[model samples]
Target: MQQNEFAIWQEFDPHAKAWQTLNNDRSRNIARKLGIGDPSTARECLDCHADAIAPEMRGDRFQISDGVGCESCHGGSELWLNSHADSSVSHNDNLKNGMYPTDQPIARARLCLSCHMGTADRMITHRIMGAGHPRLSFELDTFTWLNPHYKIGEAWTKRKGEWNGVRDWAVGQGVAAENLLEVLTNKSAGWNGIFPELVLFDCHACHQSMSDRTWGPRQGTGLGPGVVRLNDSNILMFRHVLAPIDKAAAARILEQTRGLHRATTQSRDATFAAARRLHATIDGLLPTVAAFDYGPDSLDTILSSIEADADRGEYRDYAAAEQVAMAAQSVVVAFENDGKVDSEKAAQLRSRLDTLYATIKNEDSWSRQKFRAALAALRAAAP
Candidate 1:
């Protein structure tokens, strides 16, 4: 019955709209151009936009119309469905039965990124983006908070321990960085025909208008025009996350991150070698990030590091600036919730945050100068 219960889930799901919008004749134009007869029936389109589970696993009760239901992230409900109903059953027992171990921050992040960040099983190529699919960007804590189904409270804490936004954010960065490296290393999924998957590279590198004359040399890359660069937004944010916990490791990661950018201009072999080294470094730090507690002082330090990055012109692209804006808001909200910021200061921070958000709200008109000024104002207003 759960599988056939479409009205309960699909009626409210935002993902269901992806299928609904694409199945229509008007939206299928791009898909048709790409040789896909009908996006609704196309295997490639169904993989990410809908629940494209194998037919054998999907019983008669299971239905794809329920679009990204509980089973999507929680795993199949067969084993634990009945056992989970018993009040005496502990959370660990339910997990042992079949429930996904989503309570673990890193585990949850990996599950979310499997879809958001793409994987070997489901690749989000540049062709898909060209077919009107929006550019994918995800931060775990932000998305979790945005999800309407659950709340983090006493009951949730009892089941999953205390919810830490900073930890989620940190784990998310490491997971995304790791995922990118894995994608880069995978021959089957990383390459499309003869061209490397352009979707993985920075969009702004080639998507900018011809009239834009703002191209300049970046010390981070040491490369000139026409060279596609690896998207480093996640790695850049991860550096700020590591600064308060381990300054030396953070500096080393930053150096390798720049090295990776430079390697992109050289050859595929060099890029993969550089990515492997950086991935190992990030993997080593994930455990510390998982266990560390982010107190008020640490939050302040992290925010300060982000501000420093902005001042140094590290967030020149809209993608990096958008991530920073979201991270800043998350930190400020967390501080406010913990009573670290007084009401007056909270109001001031919100005003500054509004300006920061406005700067990147419109991608076509996003100005690096306006965003930097807004970021400075936000730092000045921080308590």
Candidate 2:
């Protein structure tokens, strides 16, 4: 959140060359071409790119150039700024005074997703994407690790309490699913005239060649040929997230998700109705996922469940394949971190990891058979 998101291209390595090349210099013309160019006039552009807050709330030192500043994720500083500095004030105290509790997984996911995935109030809409905005994809742990300013060691854990990459991944998927469902069900944000928002559907589904014929059956969607399936990557990942926690619930959500896809073939009303039910299912699971402990056994379950799906031809889409690879890596590393993976197993998993990564290296060249083979190998090698 520290980088100048508007003029920025990269987040800091604590010393990344973000200031040398501004994202604004790259985006300003596009915004101008789209007719929302000026930051002074275009609040939509500033909402995600810069620290666009109310004038009354801006501190004297606050500058828009800071991009996503402390207040952007931490909340409006008016109430907690001075108090947060005092050692006597507690984290809870800061939260009580309006500081955002980013330390908590669900809360942090919600905050990061507001811009990375987008919220109704601040959407990087399909219109924006069509006009050259990059396609937004986020995995909380993956994105968080991209710009590491600190280590999560003994001192960090003491100050922040328990932290787990698997827990973060699972909670992230649930929240991401919730966010998409929220947008999908919204009257204004979810719909563009008679059609559901195109962004909610898998880009690769329609973007691929007219003669590709790569489309295949996915139990999660049940979508047939020529169908622009809704992008339920997070939803599918969320089902795996629930597997070890609540197997029955996970099974139920998967069926509901398939129903959601089927509803799309019917009518807009049917689709939204199915989406609303699935949203409630995921919403209820978030609390349990956040608080649940993820041990070696649970991590193994996650890995295997993802593999089982892929093997069954349930993850044929490029986006879903991408998510599965990430989920496997997160779960395997979490197992290794907990000292559950032996050296030989770890080495094998790493080799398989390379294979898995190689399969999805190029979205345009994504092959269901190749990805499934890589995942099967990874699952076999995983501890």
C-alpha lDDT of residue 354 in model 2 = 85
Which number leads on TM-score?
1
**Taking the tens digit of each residue's C-alpha lDDT, what string does model 1 give over 1-383?**
12333453456657656567666776588688788888877887777666778899896788666556677777888888877656688888889878898778899999888878798778878888887777888888777776345556786687669978888888888888899888987888887877788888888988899898987665555567777877888988999889789999988988898888888777879988998999999999999998988777788889889988876778877778888988888887888978888999998899899999999998777999999999889888776
Worst 10 residues of 2 by lDDT: 13-22
Error (Å) of candidate 2 at residue 280 is 1.3
Model 2, which residues run further than 4 Å from truth? 1-25, 39-41, 82-87, 343-347
Error of 2 at 301 (Å): 0.9
Q: What is the Cα-based lDDT of residue 234 in candidate 1?
A: 90
Cα miss at 124, model 1 (Å)? 0.8
lDDT of each: 0.81, 0.80
lDDT at residue 62 of model 2 (Cα atoms): 79
